[model samples]
Target chain A: MAIESIDQTSSHLKLSNPDSTTLVIHLTDDWRTTSHLAAFENVCQGLETMPSLNKVLFDASGLTGWDSKLLTFVLKVRGWCDDRKVDLALEGLPGGVQRLLHLALAVPERQGARKDAERQPFFPRVGEKALQVYASAGEMLAFLGSACVAFGQLLKGKASFRRSDLMLFVQESGVQAFGIVSLVSILVGLIFAFIGAIQLKTFGAQIYVADLVGIAMVRVMGAVMAGIIMAGRTGANYAAQLGTMQVNEEIDALQTLGISPMEFLVLPRMMALILMMPLLCVYADIMGILGGLIVGVTMLDLNPVVYLNETKASFNMTNLWIGLIYSAMFGVIIALSGCLRGIQCGRSASAVGDATTSAVVTGIVSIIIATAILTVIFSILNV
Target chain B: MNEAEPQIVVKDLDMGYGSFILIRNLNFIVNKGDIFIIMGGSGCGKSTLLKLLVGLKEPLSGQVFYDGTSFWEAGPEEQKRIMRRFGILYQSGALWSSMTLAENVAIPLEQYTSMTRAEIQDLVSLKLALVGLAGFEDFYPSEISGGMRKRAGLARAMALDPDILFFDEPSAGLDPVSARLLDDLILELRDSLGTTFVVVTHELGSIFAIGNNSVYLDVQTRTMTASGDPNRLLAESKDPTVRAFLTRGAEGK
Candidate 1:
């Protein structure tokens, strides 16, 4: 009887050659998952030393306690034995371990069901990402086309959506957003006046700080800041709301009920933001100019009346109209980006989160790009 | 067999949200290894009862006992310890959308056990294999079909090998064959591992196929109308409501 033993701190295993065709595995001690256990490789080494083993029997009578760790080791051995066409006898093991092994191995894994999680080469991954971006651009164009069609239907008085929903969205995106708009606009105006006052003070042109704050706030800063706020706040909210609806299959239900989601869902949101943007920009401009007055009176020691008169002189219809135009365009960009990303959201919780993030990013990036293009056009026109 | 030991006991349990009581004075006993079914018509608080039993929602009054310890009255630490021994399968197979099937099954084991990464992977594979999903480990929940997702959810539920499993509408959205296959799996798991099951379903085929014990909730009365073996209830129940529910599939078949 030639026997080989492999002992670990928490478990023990012994391999014995009872006959040339049969092998016996003796297991002892606690084989709990938290305990250090004997490795299955030792059994493989022992089997390699033996000649023409046809049967393997487990003797776990010395086991004090066991859990899934022991089961895992035995299963590995059983799999190895199965590949080698060796019979595995479990009658010598404990009753619980035997039953558990039988249960776990009862259902064989389906072939071709597992997917390999291999990483692609760097170039292929880059190519895949580029293709995805191109495809998404096409999807965005399609979504914009549908939005135009919905707007056309609205002009023709044939658009089908709840008027109440539009009213609710108007309240949500317009009046409810005033507190944040006021806070951001005032802070931006204060910073602009502070910077302009320092420069103008060196030239004894402190009065020009009023003109600087007024013209900047009216021309671009007011609209840009409001657009950014809406992008992060209302735009993200739009994406999350619609994305959740997509996840819950509410959009599908709407389609099944023969209602156009573009008309019923997207249109109301776009209209609300479009109608609110110009008005919000005007309100933000007033708040910004008021902030400039505060800085002029407190920091620059300018009379409040003088600051107001200088600000009034800086005002003109062209700059006001240009800023309004920017606000309107930004409103459209924010709404379209938010709704497009939301509509394209995949059906998962993480997909909704991605859609929300993408909406804010797309909204902000396009807003800046549109501002740059519009500013260049206005400067060339000398308006 | 010997006298079956009680695994879960509900006494004078009242479940509801706010002031509206949905189920009142509910009492039942789930013995060890019993495939217990909670059945009722639509809108009869079957799922609510499940929520109460699983510690997701508090009972309005009275007690829920697991192995003779009161669940609601227990401290938070004790409640968490007791809850750790439960496995729940939601109606929609609510798998984590961000993780693959392997990761989903591996989470509970990682959180609760000190097993090495390799051992956890082995246990994850075994659990997935038990639910007939051995090869689909790398796939995400959204990548699979509805039936496959349910099976994957079952694999995750069984990852920690809980003593009690709570299933909410296991066959709600599955086709007939897939539903029957799941029923068979439940039966096999119960027979082999002796895990207690509390299944909330109205599907008659599943109710009769796997449930050896059950409690029927009544919507109008806001309480349980019957409690016993599902087969025995079907054969001997005299309550017309219970009779109607049990024989619902008879007319369709």
Candidate 2:
């Protein structure tokens, strides 16, 4: 028997045949993970060149150092040999590499464990998304029903939630949020006055800036700005808090203790928002008018007294009532969406984040939809 | 028994959250290749002690030394160099919910190593396969079982081939079979890799199964009541609290 060296093409690897039925892989040089090593395909190519290969042996006498990269290459070779029922000798490898290989292969993979990345066809994906949307709608409806039941219980004074929690939620969603609401409402009013003055001044109808800002602020802009602010701020907070509680199994704890999470958690938040929205809307209206007055006096060159008089004369009770109604509806929509998303959140950190984002989106979308419906109704009723 | 060099030494460690001391004057030594258990009754600050050991929280007053270098006293770069050698498996697995299992395991390797993307992928598969999660590379943390998630966490922790691994309540939510398997895996890893383990758990099964050395924190006294081999402590310790805990309160009765 003659051992003849065959391939010394790659510096890190060599191939030889001791017998026609056996192939010996000669590993050389540093095979550290950070260092470049011969590709697994080189070994495979060597195996292919030998037709009657029944055994694979390693000659690592030339190998200076090795790490996981060497082991990975060996494993790939082992897998290839296993598929062909060929003998693979590990005795020539380092002791540490042998031990790691043994440990890695000790446990057989569970059947059907791997989730293959199967991209569904377009129609199936669309159908799956539709099904998910349907399921979500069902969950939202059920949550809304539960909320209604909790409100009913409250009317009968039988709801089982702490008064302190209610008070705390009221303080959070109301008093703590005033600064942001005021700032946004005033800015909205000022922008409205500036745009109106620009257009009205072209026709020398600058005094009509007071009419435009006054009517728009009282009719819709004030309530809409406040609603958007609360949706992003308080609505997201509600979702995050409840989603975390859900993650920690606090909701389950309440259920185990014969407490309704609806009453204990959702009721307080809803009540607080509903109670505060109209008040916040009214404050926003005043602030918006004040902002418009600033523009009217400085930008429009109108007297402050005349601008205030014009605003008062332009504003009617109908517009004020409509704005309050919009805020009240927005409060319900925001609180419901936030609470619903939170309660329906999956038990994971990222799920809480997704819940917060969904809460804000759902709140804002529902508010706009509600405003559109209410505006159409008020117009038809000639209010 | 031959005394191996101390891998971690805690001296006069005081741990608490502002004015309320949970455990004070805690001292212990974890030898190289030892599976050191931190055990106590509920609310005894076992997790907090694990936090201190892993550099998550600073000790109120004392020192944590790893291989003779003080952890808290080390410069930021020095501390990071030390921390890079540690692998911590938090309770509940704590896998990033947004990432698939493969991504979670590959992050540390990608951050710390100059390995190519293919090498990183191969290592990720190897690590995952080591923990019996070979084929579950694409699954997210939320998609797996609790036990599987823990194993994935273990795989990610082992990504850097850390010298020391810390586990917080490794068997907290596992079934009996799963918990036993986890215990076996820990023992096998320690035996094969000679990786030191610091585990916080009150599970009597685990404490007796894998622990070669242990420390018991007493909630009532707010201090470490016992330290040494758990089996030996069960036999020879004179403290009633230690006896009661090891016997699951049967000795007190």
Candidate 3:
């Protein structure tokens, strides 16, 4: 009998080849992962030498412990036997273990199961991403141009989006934004007054803090701060909401129903933000002046009347108009960034999250760039 | 598995969100190893019913019991313990998109058990193979086909080897062949493992193929208008709505 050439591990696995036709592997009492896999691999190598072996009957009657280690070993043995076209069977393994093994090997590896794409060079990857951004910018510009057309149609009383939807967007972009706008604008005004007080105190001109805060807030700080807040709040909200609808195929459904997404979705948001930004800037201007008045009265012990007169004297009509104009421009950019990212969102949940993040970033960056350009233009015009 | 003891029982159930009662006065018992189905037309709250049963949404009234334990009445801790025994396959395959398929299936095991990484990996491979996704261990959900995603979802559901499995529209959006493969896989698991199934679907072919006990929810009436075997209902029920649904609006031969 071929059982003479037996490989044995007292506490682990044992292979007893009783004949050329059958190899009876007697698994020991311990087959846990701690037993390691060398004893099992010995069986696999043993099968390579047994060219006459036609069947494998694993007698696990004496096995007291089993885990994934044992199953891993068993699957390998099964594969080796399969390669040689030998019959392999588990005679007395536990029912759960047997079922698990059967289930694991029930389905063969599916053809073409994994798609492994080759990695691109660093330059190519960067170039591809740059090209994507360029393409996205073009799409965003096209959307903005169409939104302008929709605005002209609305002026002529011919735009077709639901009036209620426009009202809702106004409430969303205007009223819902007030709490955050007031909070940010007041804080910036206080900060400006404090910083100006520190410098003005050296010359015994602390009342000029009101002049500094009022001029800065009305000309730039108030609108820029409120614009950044809206970009993070309502702009990101628009992107996420539309991105989710895109994920759910609602945008596709709307198109199939013969509705223009630009007219129905983008125009309303753009117009609402555009119309609301100037009004919000006016409120912010007043709030910032009050904030400066708070610091000038309390921190510097200046009379409220004196601070108010200084703030009034700092205001110029052209600077106020330019600030409102900048606020409206920032609003258009924020609306376009949010809506464009949403309309171009990929059809997935994670894609929606990405769109929201990109919208916030794009809106804030565009606001900063526009702020710099407007400052240069105002200084050139001697405002 | 005790044949005499019912695995789940819903008594006088009323399911809805907030004040809107979608279905009321519901009653059902899912005996051990039975393929119990909740069938209805679109917007009939079949998925909502599944949510209430799975504890995703609270019932407007009444209670659901799992193996003599009240799901709603249990303390939060006890309810979580009971819910651990349930495995649900969502309609969209709700796989974590950021993770690989193997990682998705291993999550429940890692959460509930102290299995080692290698052990969990082995079980992940086994589970994926069970649903014909043997070599798709490292692929993300986006790379896979819709039909394959459903099967992978099934694999993730079965990862914990739970006593009861819940499937929501498993065959929806799948081609007929993939759909039949899923039905066959469901039948195979039920037959071999004696696992109880509660499926929500409107596909008639899937119903007659795998459903042994079903309740039909009529949208017009907004209640369970019919219950029992689908085939017998098709033959004997005189309710035109039930007949129309069972036959899928086709004239009976």
Candidate 4:
């Protein structure tokens, strides 16, 4: 055995015995994160020339010390060997380190640790998405059907729900929602008057800004504005509350205790929203008319009494009824989507967040769609 | 060169919330390679003191030194650098809920090191394996059991190869078998790596098994009332409170 046969280096690590079938990397560094890192640069360089080598091992019982740095480097080497189908082992290492290595390697990498999820072609992906939508729609219908059944039980005075819970939800979806509703309504009214005044002033019809604002507030903007606000505020809140309960397994616990979650939870929230929505629409309309009055009095140089008279003239019974009816429809859609998302929430914190976001998106999209359809029908009927 | 100096030193430390001092006049030294424990009853501000030591909270008065450099007196960049050396395991594991375990470990390495993705991935798997979570890189924190989350938290703590690890109730929610395994892992890491540990726990098994030095924080007095080796303190402590606490209220028996 020639003494010079085993190659060594000035640094604490080296690649040795390149000519032999086995490859040996030696470690002599007092490995640490602070002072020195196990760079393994030399050994990595040597592996390039050792083409026929099939075995690898570590001799790390140098002079001083070691830590996870050394272990990390060794694990990297182990990974390299595994890829190349080489036998690797640890020798002449401390007992503690050897034991740690044993424990680390004790459990084989778990099955499905690296799932190479197959990528489908575009058409297949589109088909899958359509199928998913169909399944979701079916689930939604089933959920609404069950909710109606619970509502029937409630009407018969046999549902297991607390009136106080319904009242609390009503307060949350209505009274607590007043600030945002007022804010959005006022802004929308201001925007309407400003846009209308810009065009009306060209035709000396600037005073008609009040009529435009009042008519829009009572006809379409009131319900749509309130619907969007509630979607962001109360709808998101409902989904988050349900999602958290789902995450905590409270819904599961309720079911385990022989309680119907739909009857006890969903019914109350739905009733609260349905009961408060039309009232909120009326309040929103008043706020919006007040906003238009501010714009008319400030920007249009119109008298307050004249603006009020114009608003009164623009108000029609059919427009008011349609606005209230649309708000009621919005309430149902928002409540249904929020409660459905909550009930179907996955058991994770991120899932709760996603449910809340999905609730808002679903609520807003449905409101917009219903508005378009309602407006088209009303125009055809000349109402 | 660093062997003669203490790894950590706490001097005249005062901890509390806004003006209410929780623990005052705290002083201690953790020699290199020591498993120094900070023990107290619940609500005694054990976690608060830990925050102060780890530079998370400002002390009302006092100083903490790492390798004789006062942590509070250091510049912002120096303080940040000091903080990077710490491996803190909070009571709840505190793993990022959104990321998978592998991604959780990879974040620190990615931020601090200039390693390639392949190298970072290999290190991530190795760290997970060290915590007995080898095959669980793709699993999110919520999908795993509580014990597994704790283990994964430990894996993340060791991701950057910290010099000193601070644990808040490492064995709090673990079962007996898992707790013992954690204790064993802690001991083995200490022995093999010479990494210092400053753990906050009241679990007697862990205290006796791994702690070579410790300080007792009194709940009633809101002060650290005792300091020394735990075994020697148990046998020779004259204070009834210290004796009761050390013997776990079985002192007379």
Tens digit per residue, CA lDDT, model 3, B1-253 = 4544688998999887778777888888888888898998888899888877777678888989999999889996777677777878877776655458997787678666889989999999999998889999999988998788878878988988888899999999899988999899889888898888999999899999998888988776778888877778888888888887888778531
Cα lDDT tens digits for candidate 1, B53-147: 88767888989999999998889667878888888887777675546999878767765789998999999999888878889989998899988
Tens digits of per-residue lDDT, candidate 3, A36-152, equal 545555667777777798988878888888898888877888888888899988765778788998889786674444676889999999999999989877887788788888788
lDDT at residue B177 of model 3 (Cα atoms): 88
Evaluate every candidate with DockQ and list the scores.
0.02, 0.02, 0.02, 0.01
The most accurate candidate by lDDT is 2
Q: Which residue runs does candidate 4 get wrong by more than 4 Å?
A: A3-10, A34-45, A61-63, A82-85, A117-127, B1-253
**In order, what lDDT does every prediction score?**
0.87, 0.88, 0.83, 0.83
Of 1 and 2, the candidate ranking higher by lDDT: 2
Tell me the docking grade of candidate 1: incorrect
Model 2 Cα displacement at B26 (Å)?
45
lDDT value, residue B196 of candidate 3: 88
A1-383 in candidate 2: lDDT tens per residue? 68787764488888888899998888888988888777788668778888888999988998999988898899999999999999999999888889999999986774545898899999999999999999989988899999999999999998867676789889998999899988988888899999999899999998888889889988898889889999999999999988987785445434422347798789999999999999899999999988998999988899999998989899999999999999988999999999999988998999999999999999999988888999899999998
Query: What's model 4's lDDT at B198?
Result: 90
lDDT of 3 at A341: 88
> Cα miss at B159, model 1 (Å)?
44
TM-score of each: 0.61, 0.63, 0.56, 0.59
lDDT of 2 by residue, B128-214 (tens): 998889999999888999889988988988888889999999999888988898899899888888899999998998999999999
Kindly report which residue pairs in candidate 1 clash with one another: A114-B135
Q: Is the docking of candidate 2 incorrect, acceptable, medium or high quality?
A: incorrect
